[model samples]
Target: MRDSFDPSASEIETTTAEEGKTRKRPRPGERRLQILQVLAEMLQNPKGERVTTAALAAKIQVSEAALYRHFASKAQMFEGLISFIEQTVFGLINQINQKEESGLAQARGILQMLLFFAEKNPGMTRVLLGDALLQEDDRLQERITQVLDRVETSLKQALRIAQTQGGTWANVSQDEVSIRAAMLMSYVLGRWHRFARSGFKKLPTEASDISLRILLSE
Candidate 1:
């Protein structure tokens, strides 16, 4: 993936019928995406403060009222970012599960992909760590909890399959697999938290391969 996130032209057109004089106006639904992209970019700042609608509007050269046109409230805007994270990560996870034959390998790849994604998208890492969601609606944090649960479920499935295939942990029961999956989630969360708290200086992937080898080894 590209180092920074940018919306494709097809995804966001510059001209709309409302903005006359043939000037480029944001297309339908494009403004919402532009808003979300700008929000992500602002969150990338390691020392960034709690984002306000006024600041976000200033960044995009729009009035706060204009921002309200696309989203009912700032929390809704954040929900958009969280939704993107869920879709992107889970879609990639599905691919990993489908393509990889070795269950342990699938689990490993999912963890690596999580780190790699955070490394590329520093702003999103803030969201993953709950730094950006501070003081937001309680439900936003709940949504993150759900996302983590889904990740754990995926890990558990891969591990159970691995045991059945006699790759590793062949003698383990479902309960053990569940415990290991929880451990994997904890590992991922810890790495993400460190990355965010260190001003994005400490990478999630630092020493990750060796660590995962030890964690996944039987």
Candidate 2:
């Protein structure tokens, strides 16, 4: 049950012999990871400018052609980052669901997990908020939207479960569940937006203890 994703873990190294001298090189598929890591790092820039393939290639000390060899286009690189965000986030959500029997506790765990993840991965926060997807492929934003919808669905399920368990929400209608779920989702998105817009100085988890208590209170 890992709590966060480590971008540095994606790095790989290998040795290659070039004319009798050994040099370090990235193994197959390692360059792709490196590219994503660098892109994420660049997105941490507060300027919020659209990242160009040329800029990405320069950051990694590779020609644009080399990048294309790994990723067909800039969109593909962003897709890679999105894939990482999805896998990490949903994986944790699944863990929270499996370990917690109380729906309210599960909801609290999920919300806290999201904030902690964003606090740790500032660049991924931009991706989750669609800030990094600006001016890029339309499908990228669509994918992010889908991810958010699923998160809201998860929250709804947790709230519904709580209601069924005869707690504060026991008499609540499904519409109420939906509304609460939407509110929770909006809160997370607002925190992420502020964290990114503030140059990552404002952590998503800042004051989360009191906030979560209020949000999850009966």
Candidate 3:
């Protein structure tokens, strides 16, 4: 399993030397990625202030007009981050489903993956919990909510598999499977919220093993 998220080497900026002078320029699509990367880093601030375009542009050493050249608006930049979150997460979920045979084990793996992702990416944690989007566009928050709902759906599928496999959850009803999935989703979100709210001092995976054992136990 991947332990951390990082941009590809190709996405990083590079410099070219010409005529005794070195000039740094981002490759095609690199500046757009750099913008998103800086934004995520700024969000790591524990203060949790709304990230403004001015601050973002200043951090990137680019004018506001330059940022607009890559992204039409601040919301589009956020959408870029959100898209990263969705792709990284769902891609992993598909992997877990493919490798894990037991349904309960799948659920456990998914939950652990989520916590680990948040613990590793503090800035993205705020994005996951919607704290970073509080004052931003309502559509941004809505998109996050949709991502969360999809996560819950994945959990439900795993629980349903466990329920059918004749084990501790063999007798669990369909409705009960749904309820359990929701509870697990809530737990994951609560951990993320605490981690972000505490200025990243509180790790999401702190004591998660014991907690998951209890949560997954009959």
**Which candidate model has the greater TM-score, 1 or 2?**
2
Please rank every candidate by TM-score, starting with the best.
3, 2, 1
What lDDT is reached at residue 124 by model 2? 84
Candidate with top lDDT is 3
Worst 10 residues of 2 by lDDT: 1-10
List candidate 1 segments past 4 Å from native: 1-4, 7-23
User: Cα deviation of 46 in candidate 2 (Å)?
Assistant: 1.9
TM-score of 1: 0.90
Off by over 4 Å in 3: 1-21
* Best model per TM-score: 3
Clash pairs for candidate 3? none
lDDT of each: 0.87, 0.87, 0.90
Q: Tell me the spans in candidate 2 whose CA falls farther than 4 Å from its real position.
A: 1-25
Question: Tens digit of lDDT per residue, candidate 2, span 22-94?
Answer: 5477777778888888998888888788789999999998999999999988899999988888888899999
Overlapping backbone residue pairs in candidate 2 total: 0
Clashing residue pairs in candidate 1 are none
Error of 3 at 21 (Å): 5.0
